[model samples]
Target chain A: MKTHTLSSHIISYVLLFCIGLFLVTFSIYYYFTRSTIQETTKENAVALANNTVNRIELVLNTEERIPEIVAKMLESSFLDRDSLIPFLKSILKNNKNICGSSISYEPNYFPDKGMFYAPYVFRQGSKIRSTMLGNENYEYAFMDWYQIPKMTQTPYWSEPYFDEGGGNMLMTTYSVPFYTYKKRERTFSGVVTIDISLEWLTKIMSTVKIFKTGYAFLISQNGTIITHPNKDYVMNQSIFTIAKENNQPGMRDIGRQMIKGGGNFASADFKSKWHPGKLWINYKGLPSSHWSIGVIYPESEMFASLHQINIILICLIVVGLFLLSLFTVKIIRKLTSPLKHFADSARLIAAGDFNVQLPEIKTQDEMKELYNSFSYMQKELAEYIVSLKDTTAAKEKIESELRIASEIQMAMIPHIFPPFPDLPQVDVFAVLKSAKEVGGDLYDFFVIDGNKFCFAIGDVSGKGVPASLFMAVTRTLVRSISDKEISPSVIVSTLNKSLSSNNESSMFVTFFLGVLDLATGELRYSNAGHNPPVVIRGNGDVIMFEKTKYIPVGLFEDFDYGELSLQLAPGDKIFLYTDGVSEAENVENKLFGEDNLMKVIGENVKASPRDLIHNMEVGLAEHVKGHTQSDDITMMTIVYNG
Target chain B: MNVLVTSSNDYTIVTIEGRIDATSSNEFEKSVMEVIEEGNTKIILDCSGLNYISSSGLRVFLIALKKMKAIKGQLKLCNLQPVIQGIFDVSGFATIFSIFPDQKSAMER
Candidate 1:
């Protein structure tokens, strides 16, 4: 029941469709773009790990070659302990990667030397410093850097440790054993070592960053974290210890893989102590150092750019939808603009403006079709109005003419009250009410002579103009034939004869004629196919003249009528009426029958003729109760006073 | 008003029913005239179901009666309801038209 404008309807549907399409497109775009960013970031992180590992290997390779080459040169040529200091200092000064170089002899290999003997050279700031390393507190022969090569008789890379006795810094040493060729065989004398300070690895690892919070870390071969962005984690925590502290058992697998020199981007996600969110790590092992370089990509930071892109895309889509809705409404309104004009024109036409103009349409679509229909309706309505006006005028003319004819017909009868003014012996009253503009009911009364009065009431059967004309002719015959000498029957017989002469219409009138003698109070009357009349005596006695000896007039030729006579006492009244009086109906179709008519007359018997007839009219109106008068009603009353 | 006409051996019987007022009198006239125009000389009008008749209805009867007279045909009426019989007697139609008590009697006549 609720209604909306056409523009709103169209705009709402368009917006709905557009929103649906955008949602699907956005969902698919977001899904693919997120995965692509993840794949690309993973690839980039792995590649960066490879380049960083290679860079660390380049430093470790030089340190390893320099120490091995120096150890080989010391074996080929016998070098005195005094010459070894220059050799160590020259090596430390020339090779910037080597932080420290040391040579240790077997305890008491020189009979004059003390129990522990090693010469060490290390870089202090920009200067090289030389020192005797073995002392009562510093035992170089018992150190892993010296003991490992002495027992294996091969080169060895040591775990990074703080050399408090020698270099007094955190460093890893690659040591190779040397031989004296006594009996032309190589033998273990002592260890020649190159110490690499871990500070260079930290410098290289610090330059790596994945996205915003992603970072690179280096872990030693024993799973010890060597260099990391988190300073507390660098030298104090191993990879496994950090993993256990963070409750990430998956990180232990990655650490195990890293320590074993199994390098790859990790499949399973893990968390590092350095970050709160989940992290992805790509680790590669350095072949020269047996240490793994790992790049940790925090998952949230890696996809942060993707999230920004999605938000920006969503904003653009929302703005686009808003503008689309606005333009959709405007265009729809423009297309339906002519409908408003047509609606206005329709309203004017409905309000009786049949000639209201309709706007023209250029488009050959439904709008144009509507305009054509409106134009057609307007033209047709205008013509119909013109014809209807003429029809109404013609009908009015006929109605006015009927009104005049009705007046003329009423004038033909004896309408004046108290017809015998001079007689005074007789009182008469009559009323004729027609159902149409003209009627067939007639009543007439006149003084036939000085002592005699003639009165008649008749109803021409059938109604309207034809019956009214018949009634007029019948009245004319009654007036022309009635005389003081003629009896009531003879007068009625003559009237009937004249009416039946050219009665091709087969119409008839129920007529009643009466002549009263003013001196004797004698009345003679004849009825021709009419309801009987009622007579009321002065003594309150009622009588009905029910004799109808002849048929209705104008039905047959030369029909003889019979007369009845009644002697009326003084103040006797005779009431005559047509069937309209008895047959008058009410809303229920019940008639005011003859009994009710007589009852009304008897009740008002004491009233005079005029008052009595008025009472009868009142009784009839009360009985009908506003029902249409179906026929002409005629009533006549004569009171004879002797 | 309903007018039903049927043919017996030599006479046409017309059964008139319901009210025959001024409005319905034209239909009554047409039904009777149609029977008469069919050259049925004898018409037995059955008034058993006739409840009321206005003067206009009486005019149609008069026209029918005059037409019968001109054609020298017999128009008999039977089974008139009391009210209709009273109207007929008062209008003096009872004197001119042949009246019978029943359809069988009218047919015999």
Candidate 2:
């Protein structure tokens, strides 16, 4: 059997199991039902037959009184051979099925000479003749009843036998001896005997009859079936004989008797005279002649069991019918799942979007076939969609390239830094994190010659790539020109003259520049409209280094940039920043003002350049927490270790 | 502190020379924009010549770039030195302008 999915297989298996259970239950019921009916019917037949046989035996027992009567008659009056005939004739009159009754006594017939029934009257059909009475050849001494009286020297009875001379069946005889003795010296007087008819047995059985299909049968303890309703079937016939007639060896076996309570039963399907398919049943050894009686009907008519079996079988068949219906419905749904997908595809095709594809279902069934067809349609539709996406794809690609270029611009500045690492004499740090693609803040530093450290800071007025370009050009010019040995004021004055000539945009830088002599405590510095830097002394006083502000560089030509010098101690620091730091905002849009910057410096008044820059950033953030910054932020701190 | 600047379309290119700190920052801003009145907004600073920069120098660059913005022209850089190039990489300013390997290459762009 092929395996099925869980739910459906469980249903089918449970149904089959239930059907099997019902069938077994019905079979058991059928067996017991048929067996009960068969046993009861056999028992009734045997009991009824035995009753009839016993009734006839009573009449035969009454006939038994004749011998006692004869014995009394012989004892009361002395009976010579002549008187024996009248006595026997009187006893033989009334009963019809008996043909004759007679008695015999003689020394020649007795096995022992001391036994006697002499002067005895033995009658047969109303006469006692000489040869029948006194003349005994004694060769008949070998006869069965004669030895009983001769050996016991008393009375004897023999079963009925046919007397062919009279052509009568079952004429039984009883005999008795007349005896006299003084002290154990008994004299031999011979025996008295009487005969009886056996036709009375048949007469009683004939009145109680059974139906045609039914048979009332009897068996002897010695395996004989006698008085089997059919008179011709009377003697020596038994179940064995019937089994031999049927040629079946199974009949020879004694069938197992089923005993439950009072019920003792046996049945044979080998009942037929010629075949065993028909059932024969019996109850045997009925108290009398080792006999049993039974009523045997044709096995075909034996429906006591089959009737109940049919009912249970019907219930099983009905269950099987329902199970088949459920099975078909479940299997059909599995077969049609792919059709649902096809319908979904048709809807998608109508909507003019055909990119969806069917999922894989790997079965060599009808559903898989439908999926294959849908897969083909999906491939064609997907190709059509792909062909139409050219313009959209190119636009996305350019956008991505522009994004990369914008990131490169912002990154070109020192977005994070300790701007001068090796010059411990001048601790410096700067940051130029952008708010857009670019911003105009710029800062630079390097050892121009030995301990002569040069640095500058400036800011552009606008934002984005354009402003960044200007910042780049201006930054490069400053870095290049600062290399020439000159005072800070002269270098800037030269640059101012250079820019003022073509300053059509009227844009200018508010800037500060410085050159440090590391061996001495002096910083040559200049300012061009830039914020005054915070200066921290070696002791602890913080002061603003504000030179008289000049016009921003690049505004006009021929403007002088004044320079000043401040004596620095070994631990002096200067903090420089663009407005991006002082004007920083949080998400609340609150500005981080100059007061906060001063406060931050006051708090970390003796920090190193890096720590000063970091502490100022912290203060700005604390002043304007949770607000987004509005401009590019750049700040730097430098310490002098002169 | 890295720099790369170039000149094109009638502008003479001038690149910054070194790290601009509190000491040299004001001078650095003055040197770069000195050519602005000479009609050179179409200038590219070869930031490759600049060794370092700080926030003060950033403020000067802001001031000069705005001047060019008002003048209605362009400035670009060519060839950035690596350390300053990393700053540009971090700040996302590489997207803000055109950059090239040299003066002639930037002028061609």
Candidate 3:
């Protein structure tokens, strides 16, 4: 009865469950996939950093060993300084990765060369140029490349610097100390050095790519940026200076760790003015130069695959849930379609249309069972309704027939109250009330001759149609016989013989017949098992006639009947009634007996016959209240006015 | 109304109970007619339990009487209450049909 639909409810719940499952599954899958991609990207960055470091180390190692080899050759008396210039020129010309090579002596340790004398050969744009160092303004003996190897008596690599004296480029010098035996003890000789331009290293760092936006950079032992993609900061900016300029102390910490020969992969929110977000940095320390190679990438670029995957996952879940909801709605619609039809059919049935055609369902499930039940109920209801209609129609037919029979019965009685209007000697009134549709009580009065009046009242043995028929027969017989026979007793006796002759129904009637002679004022009456009539005197005295011993008429043949004769004075009235009056019952089941009937008539003794009958009717009505009349009531009154 | 039938020898005793008015007279007719149709022409209507009878009830009896007469058999009425006997007397039906005060008298008749 509620307005909510079942399909919507089912679809909503199912879609909710599916979407919830999808969201949880997608979230977990996205989480693990993102973590794996990040780990793989970090490893890739580390490998790229390792490769760049190894390549730079290999170039630096080759250039540093060239000077050491030359110094060993001179110590073994392989060549002199005159031969070293041409050899250095040949070495510089032969090796393309090396920008230049210089052998700077420590204050002219060569005997052939004076103090502060140095020989250097460098590449001059596809040509090898030989030059001597140790000028007044640029003393090779005081330079870091010469001083460091002489003091440490070992091979050393100088920090990257601008070479203004010979190489004229950003270069790092690798120096090695040469020695010759003087007094059977090794002594420090001039430093053999090679100037390696950092241009090629910068090119290598730029070419080593980590993902899309990741690039590599080289930092020297003192945290100086040797080679960087941003060339402006390559020679001028140290890692500490860059970190301070960018307001990133975390970056400075990473720089310190890298320079200490520690390799690490870490992420930091290094807010540079140019790049403000987080960065992932993978740094490795170079073994040869104590430099660190760092592959730095922005966090967004490093996790770009993860971002793409998240977008794809969200799209997949949304599309999946949408399709799931569509299918769920469709399926639920199909399932509940029968229910909707059932509701429609039930509505029609409630509206009293039992002839509705229900939809058929063939599925072997609950819906089929439900449809069958509905059809069965509809058929049963229709049958019940039809049976009820038949019963009502039958009852109505009987009632109508009863009504017609009653009408015919009532027509049989003398309905006109005043029988003899011209005969002022008598005033008569009569009323008949049938308890059922047709009654057996009947009364008739006729003038036999000019001088005699014959009147009779009788009740048949039973009531309804058969009794009414008998009453008709008796009235006809009485009238027919009264015309030929004038004596009241003879008339009744003759009528009884006729009625009793062929009566096979065992039916009878209580009857009384009276004849009045106007000339003599004599009233003669015969009683046949009927109630005694009452004579009310003009002085309000009520007297009941003696009841006769004879049985009712129509019950016996040749039965002796008795007649009583009464002389009526002027203003005397005789009241005749059937047992229906004397036996009428009230609410308490008390009857309107003869005593009550006499009292009612005695009170209205002086009234006209019509008024007297009316008063008696009122009295009987009051006595009975509103209870059902058990029998037909028939009464007649005659007031003599002679 | 209820009709109970009992048979002995050549007579069927139909004991009718309650009032047989226009409404219940059809049932009374059916019961009595069924006995007549079964060739049980000699029948006794026991009215001991019958409180009243209307004209319709009388009609059923008449129909039964006619059927019995046609078959040259007798239909008797017995155990009539005073009120019912009074109806029979007033209608002058006491002479045409044989009636007895009890079942034994009716059976002998």
Q: Write the per-residue lDDT of candidate 2 for residues A1-642, one digit (tens) a residue.
A: 426644466667777786788779768877787778666666666666557656755675576566666666655545555666666555555545445544555444345534433333233455543234333444344566666677777666554456666554645566666553435665544455666555665555456554335555544344554455665556545556656776756665532221110112345645555323566554433332223445455555555346656767787678876876587657756665556667777788768767655655778876677677777777776676676576568867766765675566555555545555666666677767666656767776667777787778776655555557667766777776877855899878877776667766555666678888888867898877666778877777888765344655766576677899988888888888876776576665455766788878888877766787788777876876756554667787778875
lDDT per residue for candidate 1 within A496-562, as digits (tens), equals 8888898887889888888888888788888898888889888887777775857988888877888
TM-score of each: 0.81, 0.39, 0.55
Candidate 2's error at A602, in angstroms?
54
Quote the positional error of residue A538 for candidate 2 in Å: 55
Error of 1 at A481 (Å): 3.1
Candidate 1 chain A TM is 0.76
**For model 3 chain A, where is the 10-residue window of minimal lDDT?**
A268-277
In terms of lDDT, which candidate is stronger, 1 or 2? 1
> What is the C-alpha DockQ of each candidate?
0.70, 0.02, 0.14
**Which clashing pairs does model 1 show?**
none
Docking class of 1: medium
Of the candidates shown, which would achieve the greatest lDDT relative to the real structure? 1
As for TM-score, the candidate ahead, 2 or 3, is 3
All-Cα superposition RMSD per candidate = 5.4, 19.1, 9.5
TM-score of candidate 2 to 2 decimals: 0.39
In model 1, which regions exceed 4 Å deviation? Answer: A1-5, A20-28, A35-43, A46-96, A101-121, A124-132, A140-194, A198-200, A212-214, A217-330, A414-424, A483-486, A538-544, A586-588, A598-627
- List candidate 3 stretches off by more than 4 Å: A1-5, A74-82, A108-114, A164-168, A328-335, A360-362, A392-642, B1-109
Mark the 10 consecutive residues where model 2 chain A has the least summed lDDT.
A255-264
Tens digit of lDDT per residue, candidate 3, span B1-109? Answer: 9999998777899998998876788788888888889888688999999976665566577667667877998899999998778656644455556889999888775
Cα shift from native, residue A421, model 3 (Å): 21
